[model samples]
Target: AEKGTDRSTLMDILWDVQRRKRYISEDDIGKIGQAFNMSKTELEGVITFYHFFSTTNRGKYTIYLNDSIVANQSGRKAIQRAFEEALGIKLGHVTPDNMFGLYRTPCIGLSDQEPSCLINFKPFTNLTRDRVFEIVTELKSGKRPSELCDIPKSIIHYTPAEERTVFFKPYRQFSSLSILNTYSPEEIIDLVKKSKLTGRGGAFFPTGLKWEFCRNNPSEIKYIICNADEGEPGTFKDRVLMEEHPELMIEGMIFAAYAVGASEGAIYLRAEYMYLRDRLEELLSKYRSQGYLGKGIKAKTPFDFDVYIHMGAGAYVCGEETALIHSMEGKRGEPGTREFFPVEKGFNDRPTIVNNVETLCAVPRILEMGISKYLSLGTKATPGTKLFSVSGDCSKPGMYEIEWGMKLRDFLDLIGAEDPCFILFNGFAGECLSEADFDREISGENLLAEHMQFRFKDPLEYARKMGGIGLRSGGSFMVFNKQRDLLKILKNVADFFVAESCGICVPCRTGNFLLNKKIDKLILGHAEQQDLDEIKEWSNIIKITSRCGLGKMSSTALNHAMLKFPEVFEKRISANTDFNKSFSLEGATADYDRIINEMTLDYD
Candidate 1:
């Protein structure tokens, strides 16, 4: 805690080392361990647990190509092959020239413009074979990557508050940290509940209740954690909020700390947003300089709360609250059993409340304009507006904030999703609703459950329907047109869960692996009727027995895709019934076979 800040940052040290030296080394690890008073093995454990922390300086420019579903459908396979052939180096390897390191990442949040890559954390989207070569030529010619960077203006198209609230109102305005002195902590909690605010981080937990729990938990210390590790694929709204309106969020955190009796607050941002670190640090220092932060903020109340940002090192599972707590404490970012929630025990075993980035961003608006005005904006069940990251086959593929309960069809038309046939709601871990559900409203209420409730008068009779998929999103919705392959898309979704699973529980570890294998068999047309039954069995087992939310939702995309698009698999089975591989193999090996034959002429 030296530097007037909580410096328990393993991820930060690793990131600093990687940026400075291109990679981390064992000697560097020893020095870091000694400086931080940590075990050397523990330091290495943290590095290996994350995918972004590498140990070798393989190349000067690290190229992370997007291998997500959106990219693949947009001809990422051909683009990857083109890069391999042009560079003369296979993926996961650096060329002898030490120019580039090719790696595959899940998603860099640009599902709108697919076949994308991040050269040293800068995004380059909508890549063609020619464009890849052209960019490579520039990189090789000592050109900066930022020269080719495509920075879009206002990724969030509009602010919901408009001219009514101060969120997106004016530039560098004074945040209402002074307003916290006007209300007691209990009254503040009542205002949040009156606003009917809930967590926007997928779980839909009540934000007010969460704060109330930690506030009443009687501890020597408490913490407020804004979960900004927006690792969900196709989600980039948080990045825009964090980069553009960070002060609004910081003000929210300070208000939250005052309400919950927390001395410290932290914002855990993902490592992919590493470029914004210096700007955020400078903002914090500026606030501290003005007496809005550090001891006795505004000198009105004893709310000595300051916020810090923690970087997550490429683990999607850390989006879960408990797993995030573990990462912040310099341990493996894995979820623990949920007997005691974070409101009871979290972040150094202190009572803590974890709010999502959007949730925090929305807080300042509610506090300023009063809770009634916020509640009047959206549906009865879910009040206020929410942000959505719309991409995939959309004319305007960017962020938008709208009042909830809008028709799905109207949303598609507004965003210009031409010929939209499918909806991948809330990334791979969320639902896959079909075109038939276009008329459905995007609200907090689950439409399938509502349908079941109204259709069947009896609660027991509701179980008889084979069921349909409903969208319950945490503000991520991706649309794919009819030209995309449904089965292959599901396979990509399955592969993401398989790659991202924490493997802490058996159901997530083994179940997601088997689920992916079944998808592979279905894609290859080698699956039997028995395989379908086995998939159902495994999916149910994983959903029921998984220890954490990630494991429980691991098979969600597959299950929903199968329900909505069963014909994709059924047609593939008939096409592969009389599979012939001889001609295909021969066609692929034509040129290579002739060269090999010439080399072995004496044997021939």
Candidate 2:
């Protein structure tokens, strides 16, 4: 109760209660609601929207096993079996002794090290069946998960000195802030514009233009938000940036604050990265002590900016800016209408500038290196290097810093992708590419120009005409060898979207569910040519009609794979034309029967 009853602090309070008591009880909810002047239903809605917060007892140790496709490929089933055997309880259940609870969650940004889990939010990576058994034994012996965590200090691949780019290069403290007084805010924006830096979060929006819009707003209160919610499956570059170079990112936020005339700022760290919170908080305190943050920062000009960390409780849709702002205001993280961008009305209805972790990390480096040096690194259209989170079927599954326009084939070679047949670029929400398009370049210019030309038209036609994939990625490059089943991968992607959809709009909510059903049909050898046609039709509708990026691009991988690898789907089609032969009543009712059985068991 001492943490003040502001609406913005509701998430923090809920997190605190959950950590202390292992669950938010009915009495706790009533007390919190009374303090915040919110109803019980409203509080329950907020709590249920996130995956991490629980209303039931989660026991002493909560284990969230990663359910990404990479994890499955790397023998997740065996590890899961080991945990179940060790704990003597199935997933989604607490042990009878009340010592542990096991659950499965989506990607936790540790795709490079598959079969990983977060025990009390502390990541334990690169797991095997034996390792899982050992971990469970140690935990039973009263060893803290934090002490037994095997997460690597750095997952970045070690490249030669010459291969190192802007982000991975050696850093100096406050190098950019030391020169903040030299240029006016407009000049600072101009320098960023000249550098041609775009949003590294995959939208590719001009960073300088976004800052310019926020700065041009006449609001007295402004906000600078660092989007550290790296929730996309197969993407973990932002996590690496936060772990290795958080100060640089914070400095970039300071630069944004100075440019946009904002005083308050925040880092929206995702719940998966709860482990990074203490270290980041310590860094923020050190900066404040060193005069790099807090009021009258560095005692320079009259401008003052301070930043705090806001934790996300596991909503993938919250990665969107409007949803993120809504989450910050202590509401369900749902994307609001885009009548006005966040720059005009955000964070309690004020001007706000939101930048991803990689985008912000580059800000201080760009200022330090100057425009000419930065621009000369990448292509003319998309200047500056990018961090690619390479994983899945690669000998070197880690973060790779490279120039923007590198070829897909070259990247595969560099990462030692063994007999790569398919690559899911960007993410599940992004496109899939086959070996036929290996010559295409990875640059924002292709995606931007193609988007301008096509503008909701047929992307497959654009690919054929341009002889390129023409899609910009958010730096998740997951490769798959020929030995892997594309259908299973497609099923995983479908399930991810279905699980993560915010259900705000009809198209995304229904479309993802239907898509997953179709993929299941194909996997079971029950899909017909008609199902394939319907899949394409539904995918197009979801992309065109969905409200936010999550819904809009939810079917991208399926669409791309259908267009790129027609043979994969063709072979899965059922030969029997009779509906009675293809469809099994028992199979169709299995899910319903299972749900009823589980509910009856709980009642008993």
Candidate 2 segments exceeding 4 Å error: 158-164, 447-472, 574-604
* Cα TM-score per model: 0.86, 0.92
Which pairs of residues collide in model 2?
A: none
Model 1 per-residue lDDT tens digits across residues 180-292:
76888888888887887877777665678678878899997999898888877888778778767888877778778888889888888787776677778888888888877
lDDT of 2: 0.85
Candidate 2 local lDDT, 410-511, one digit each (tens): 888899999999888888878787888788776655533454333436532443343212334578889999999999999999999898998989999999
How does residue 126 of candidate 1 score in lDDT?
Answer: 77
